[model samples]
Target: MAFAVTSSTAIRSSLSTPLEQPKAAQVGAFQPSDRHHLPPAAVNFSRRRCAVKPLNAEPKRNDSIVPSAATFFASEVVEKIDVEDYGKLAKDLGNASPLEIMDKALEKFGNDIAIAFSGAEDVALIEYASLTGRPFRVFSLDTGRLNPETYRFFDEVEKHYKIRIEYMFPDASEVQDLVRNKGLFSFYEDGHQECCRVRKVRPLRRALKGLRAWITGQRKDQSPGTRSEVPVVQVDPVFEGLDGGIGSLVKWNPVANVKGTDVWSFLRAMNVPVNWLHAKGYISIGCEPCTRAVLPGQHEREGRWWWEDAKAKECGLHKGNIKEQNSNGGVHANATVQEADLFNTNCVVNLSRPGIENLLKLKSRNEPWLVVLYAPWCRFCQGMEQSYVEVAEKLTGSGVKIAKFRADGEEKPFAQQELQLGSFPTILFFPKNSSRPVKLSI
Candidate 1:
């Protein structure tokens, strides 16, 4: 039977039932009767600090799809995805739906790839993978400091899924050394990076080394400053997999384009068991000491490392998101002008050359656009990124569409000729009536 967290509301309300191992039968890995006998998620939750969002009160298992269980027990050896084509593949799957992306990753890598499940909403990865009816593996980090609710939720997931989750933990010696020297809460004084490297990143590194690829639940909306450019697929720039080296590991972010609200919607609609912490305003739940509840109007990530810079909150897990500011104290894009944009934000519309032209063509449709033509590497453009995003955020309910267009590299000539782009950062206002875009002085 297909086993994924996103497919059922049959959470074992009580921890009384012994964890049952997958029962291999004549047909496949498990008997359909095995699921029918399990308990439902009727546990009484304590009142929360914040208003609790009710789970799918009805059982979703009745409608849940169960594919070939035979695919669940054993995995056949499959050819690994070619890491060299990750760039091209990324563009190809950039707009693919989350289920489509998950299916491709599971089908290509099979058991060689593992779904990285945090005790949080990432369980949706497993939910989608199981729908593909392919054999897949899963792993998670035991930071040893997670919330009690998280651990209980992990056990509940394992029990309900009828599968084992390979758990990784930080090296005992390394953890002891750090604790013995720095005491228990040094992150508050120094930073969270070092502690996270020991508890989370290192353990993850060890886990990835055993697989050819891994699937993450990362969405572009998670950490806008760091993850805004996250593609659906890519070659892992930091961690290596089974073959052991850079470019050996392929990374699949099945939900790269999915929104946070939509993820919860999927989980709820499917009747998936969610961590109890989410109801307490802990939108970005992590290790207890380092994580707190997010206040009203705050981003989910603000709960993590609240003392640190919003842009530099990554815990070394995804090194690609790490940024090093240039001497001018502005973001310095990479060598490529187009791929490297002046700023990263989900608020503004990032239009390609063709997209800009298409917007211009829609003038008769009464659509307005405030497009910024800028070079990614220009200091002035980089400096204005903050203000630009602020404007976009403020004008969200307004009719104006704030956008960015890279007016550098091969596209520079086209931008200058058609859009009247003359400077490093040119603001062009396209009104509803006229097709001609008027240049604005900013």
Candidate 2:
């Protein structure tokens, strides 16, 4: 059993020609029942052929690998099936053709579901929906900071699918408070974790409150951060509140193993619309001001927040549940905790000379300089680093005098008492002779 959208005859027909394989009826001549299962050698040969292209149809390709339906089915088998069926299913799957596996998963997940669209490779998921006639709930986060191009893509997807996409917004009050106090790009200045808690995680938690499952357009190929073996039905802890208190929400990554190039080809063939930002080389689309196109041979997410010092590349939505019941009192909401009470701290290894501080203090004497405070282990911090780097590069040798500080240990006490900083990467502009910092909007 696996979670997947079942394809209909019409959908199959639309894709049949591209497959350029013998007709199903003609191919059926070689069909084997229980015994029809090919021997291990034959299995390898048929799998190799199927891997190159769909056995019943021609394969639509992209960059990394041409995804045969086999991989998707293989990826979902564990998450969607009973333990008893797993061994036989795994053996059968290792031998059975790709087409059969895909058919089985789709049958198990059903067609009615929501596809989480971020205006990225999500289009491929949409293409699958269109080709399969599996109606899906397409949704996007109106983070209010998204680029105009993303909004335009939303409109385009509507026209292309002839369906209404659900819109999710962050809590108005929370957003207002966070933005008003921290500024728009606060995520960059204040550190990504808190910013995501306000902008992405909270909103996403609220948005997914009622849904049983969500289909993300995310692929393992996106980055090292998302490299875990994705399961089709895993509980999402962040949205635990969505469960109305118990076993609230489960996530299914239908495109978990989908490659970027495959998504692009699918989009092209389906005449699927895309945002103009992509043409500018923006592969992973999100908040416009926060994202950029990657250079050749670069990681797909390398262009994002290119100016930051940390490596957290996620926006919080993709992070597994971070909430933990605290013995002290409130719940601790870190997605990954190595050990209890041992919150992964992000600190800078300062090998720089102490004279640097005097220079920084001297520079802060002229104009308000925006400095970002952060840690290395935070994913949100990692995600925003690319954008920060770009910002720093643009302002380099300029009068702004950009600087960074790690908020831990002795520096933590100084940061709290002197700067009144409560979050990581607090982007504050230090004005001359002033105790108060003029906070700049990210």
TM-score of each: 0.59, 0.51
lDDT of each: 0.66, 0.48
Highest lDDT, which number? Answer: 1
lDDT per residue as tens, model 2, 143-164: 7877777777776666555445
Mind giving the per-residue lDDT tens digits that candidate 1 earns over 115-141? 888888998887787767666666778
lDDT agreement of model 2 with the native: 0.48
Q: Model 1: residues >4 Å from true position, as ranges?
A: 1-71, 74-84, 322-442
Clashing pairs in 1: 1-69
Highest TM-score, which number? 1
lDDT of 1 at 360: 73
RMSD values for the candidates in order, in angstroms, are: 21.3, 18.7
